[model samples]
Target chain A: MSHMEFTGKTVRDAIAKACEELEVDEALLDVEVLEESARGFLGLVGHRNARVRVRKRDVLKEVLEVERPDSRYTNIKPQEFSEIESFSKSGLEDGKITQEGALSENIDKSEIVSQAKEFLEGILCRIPVEAAVEVSVVNGSIELEITGDRSGLLIGKRGQTLDALQYILNKSINRETPLEEKTEIIVDTEDYRRRKQEILRDMALRMSQKAKKSLMPAALNPMPANERRIIHMILSEDKEVYTKSYGEGPLRRIIVYPRKAMPNKRRRR
Target chain B: MKELVEFIAKSLVDYPDEVNVSEKETEIGLILELNVAQSDLGRIIGKHGRTAKAIRTVLNSASTKRKQKVSLEIIE
Candidate 1:
């Protein structure tokens, strides 16, 4: 839908009014503040109302952008995905981060939770999605669960978008921390990661079995690095099947190669 | 294959009594599903899943002798 302009005494009021009109969470509305209200001369004689352009962020288009057949996969590592500008720009665009409190080397769990929540809120405030960032400590890593109406879009096709967001957040947060120790952060929405992991594991098994039968390498469709890691990890120690990534970016995919019938070439660690 | 997996899982897991192995015959050949006590779950899996992989290797050898297909599933 086309964006409509809303006017209020301030930017916050203008966004609030837009949210009320659209019946969506403030996070879901794409907002552009055109003019800021000003108080001049007398108390309010020359004050002009703030003007903003408001519209629902088109998640369908954003998902299509992420899932397109060409150039859908990132590098083998999540860290490399952060440098992918075309794909990540949408999620990180206009994201305003406030570096109020610097992280210490011996940071506690509550501090990590609060800082992560702050980073998430800052990023979500600019993105056209309404969601609550729930942060907690799992093991030594920071876990963030984003829950809201528009959260499914964040998952994107095959979770490439979600992974990109995570890598970006992890890289940036660590950059802010003045220490050699790095913190791992896992971002998940609606338990998507767990479900995806289970699905990937099963598919890997079924496909590896097929590869063993046909005596040919089974090539899986291009998947995010994290998902690919799941396949590699599950079958790493399998008796008659070994897995490896076989292509370059975008066209890159996993090939489950079956071990030889005879033990001529024994693969050693 | 069922008995083979049962024997291995029972020996590897702390709770040998809790080890359960079920066999299902499918077109692919045979599928063995295994369940063990949650505490001993990591024990059967071992480091980098070395233990489970070894069990599968033994089962594969036996399956070949029987001229049938078999795979193991470690149920969480």
Candidate 2:
């Protein structure tokens, strides 16, 4: 962390200078205005004093390494998921799968196998039969398409079970990624996750159209905030339909209403 | 107001046995008081009072349908 004191006409200009000097993202830094810039009647002198707490990104690299021992794995790309999915699907169709197939196949097939194995083990640990679960990383994220037999446990308890697994994996993987390129982890099961995203996107589009046609408000079934964000992002540009989130918690839903209807009223209120 | 309070309390509280509602209908509007088991209060309130506000919003919407004014109060 570095602190800089500077004088400028405006806070923005002073921050810009500090950012240039610190080489950090301005949004990430904490800024406080010590004193407002003053102007003299003669226009010869105006004094402004500002204190900026600059975040040094490099310092984070050191701290993150300490936080995540396996920081070397990061920057997994989205395209890799598709490739792994296809590879596993083709391999399964071909009727030839190795004990551990291609990296992509391994990544895609691992979760289902693991969940099934865990379930069976929990039930049959006392029995003679033994269950095994193994997962390989192909392009760092599991491919949804190639994954198989996950609809059962993956969709358990209204997706609470899946969400828990995803949360754990994401935390672990994010920690595994190196500090230089640390990123959030995203986990998927079967093609359900992608399909859900598509469904939400389509619903947003349909609701936008419906709101336009009927000139009425349409309330969608409640969903988590992430899903709501997806809908909001998709229809944000529409001229006719405006979106508002309603309800609460995991079941919180989105309302698509005609922009012309009750334009001035706050949606939640 | 009493009916509305009963409906809300019955729906929100997990321990329906302990659900209770008291109503005071004033000249201007209706005030509905809600009480439930301590264990079930969090479920009714939800994170940041979002669930409670949502329930109130729904109540408000329904109130409009009847052309009557009513408010909800959740007793801690």
| Native contacts kept, each candidate | 0.00, 0.00
Model 2 C-alpha lDDT per residue in residues A1-269, reported as the tens digit of each score: 23446556666777888778767687756676666666555666554344343443444335324222111111223223323232333344423322233333323445443543343233223211232334434444342221344424434444543454344333333333333332223445555567788998899998888877766667788876557667766666665665655443455566776765534222223
Instruction: Look at candidate 1 and give me any clashing residue pairs.
Output: A27-A129
How much does candidate 2 score in TM-score?
0.34
lDDT by residue for model 2 over B1-76, one digit each (tens)? 4554454445445676888878779987887788889998886675567556655654553455457788888898
Clashing pairs counted in every model? 1, 5
Per-residue lDDT over B1-76 for candidate 1, one digit per residue giving the tens place of the 0 to 100 score? 6765675566455688999988889988799899999998886675557566556654654565567888889999
- Report, for every candidate in turn, its global Cα lDDT versus the true structure: 0.66, 0.53
Report the poorest 10 consecutive residues by lDDT, candidate 1 chain B.
B57-66
What lDDT is obtained when candidate 1 is compared to the true structure? 0.66
TM-score of candidate 1 versus the correct structure, residues matched by position:
0.43
Q: What is the DockQ of each candidate?
A: 0.01, 0.01
CAPRI quality of model 1: incorrect
